[model samples]
Target: MNPTARQYDTVIVGGGPAGLTAALALTRYRHRTLVVESPEPPRNAASRGVHGLIGLEGATPDELRARAWEELGRYGLAERLDGRVEEITPLAEGGFDVATDHEDTIWARDVILATGVTDQYPDGVEGFAACWGRTVIHCPFCVGEENADRSWAWVADDPDHLGMTATAFRAWTGDAIAIAPPWLPGADELRRSLRERGSDLVLGEITRLHHTDGDLRAVELADGTVLERQTLLWPQPQRQVPLVERLAQDHALALNDGYVTVDEGRQTSIPGLYAAGDLTGKPWEQGVVPAVTAGSAAADAIHFATLT
Candidate 1:
């Protein structure tokens, strides 16, 4: 039982940065669009400000969204729904029908999956759970400046993550160390670079996190060795398959590395379907600009598709 409603030119899934950006473009292109978003906001604890972003640099996540909403409203081109999209089915005429967790359905000429991915942290670190997005994080560009020159540690349960995390951390601070099993990739390069940069690498498995006065203090290892550090960049395997799989199987869309496959114009495997943002497998540090650019590209493709 899908709830039927008025048909639209495009119905976007997940109204985060990408979806909203797409809506803005659609409006400018004179295409009707709607954005579906989850009520819960993105987790951003250690985030002082979104980095590498133009115009909106130093703006909090919520602030950026608010400004985007205002811009979208000015064009009367988009609307946001605080509900979950449960399903999407292809219609016969190069269009898609979407079903939501709420009792509602929407028909559209195109669909864009701007739904983001989830980052899963390592298990069994006591205070680590609470420190996520705050003192513990993954992307250095997103949280590096605030902890510069302070005590920092890189923890990874998986041994293979050392090289990549080490490289990303080096760009942020010269004083960083890796705490994980000894089986590190590019060990020679990492050790040489770390020593040259005055960083240390400790071999052990982190067992728990310690905090003082609600501030992250240090990480405790299995051998009961406590490394005193105010900030930690921990790496964990990321699982990003929910919405992309739904779109791929149900609508015959292409997927690349857990991201919806799209062409130069942002068209997906399914002709009219498009994707952008984290789900599109672009660099995660891309805050608003990339999302907006992808959305505009998709809008142009949609317009061309309708004309032909």
Candidate 2:
């Protein structure tokens, strides 16, 4: 631990929606909090705007973050540091020593792992990367309203997830198609559900995407079949940030699948270590509202724990 390290009641590892919300909650409770964020582009950097947020609908990720910081500025108990957290060392005396890439060390009595996850898209899909967050989306509810009634396709890696998403997507668009990878398990029940919902199921290896200026035109199959589509919902697999992964490995924090497992209070398996947002395992529950709720809940838990 550095002798000159700054100390706070809690240190937030990520500055995304969850981190910012937790910071705000802690500051409101008069608890000293520090938010550490990297200079790299956020996961939602390419997203045009956030949806399902009550009042800030259609606001870009930058705009949302700016507004959060603006609100945080009103509270003097919260501080922001721009740097990537390299490692976290649990102090024997109780607390944590957080090391950053900038060589700054921070000490905190409690830590909130809101580092979130990174979306992993399918490889070798031309134009897919460019259209991500616009024409190529993940959640149907998030982008459903804007792209409603448009030709839509649900490209999924798993058969179960594909069937579920395809069924739900019908609420937004009637012309929903489920494009399954060749390795996806053949489930007769899933196929029946899709057909009942008037959704088409196509099994093929996706070769590439045809698009113009981030707007999707069609999905090209390996067999030279092109399915015209204006919007695509791909619930891409998400991986935890490196910081969270290190903590999971070192501290033996519980995890469900790839996401960090947390109790109802957002408390991780490790004492004094809490987590929120996308890092917590909840694929169907990914959105700004749930992230904010998790952050707020985690902060409340921390506040109560400190009192005890």
Q: For candidate 2, lDDT tens digit of each residue in 1-308? A: 55799889999988988999999999999999999988999888888888878899999999999999999999888888998899888878889898888887788899999887898888887788898888888776777787888899888767766776555766777788788876667756667788887776888888788999988889999999999989988777888888888887887878888889889999988888899998896668887889999999999999998787
User: In candidate 2, which residue ranges exceed 4 Å CA deviation?
Assistant: 1-3, 157-167, 183-197
Model number with the top TM-score: 2
Clashing pairs in 2: none
C-alpha root-mean-square deviation, candidate 2: 2.0
lDDT, each prediction = 0.72, 0.86
- Single out the weakest 10-residue window by summed lDDT for candidate 1: 157-166
Judged by whole-model lDDT over C-alpha atoms, candidate 1 comes out at 0.72
| Candidate 1 residue spans exceeding 4 A from truth | 1-4, 43-46, 156-171, 182-197, 212-214, 282-286
Model 2: ten consecutive residues of lowest lDDT: 161-170
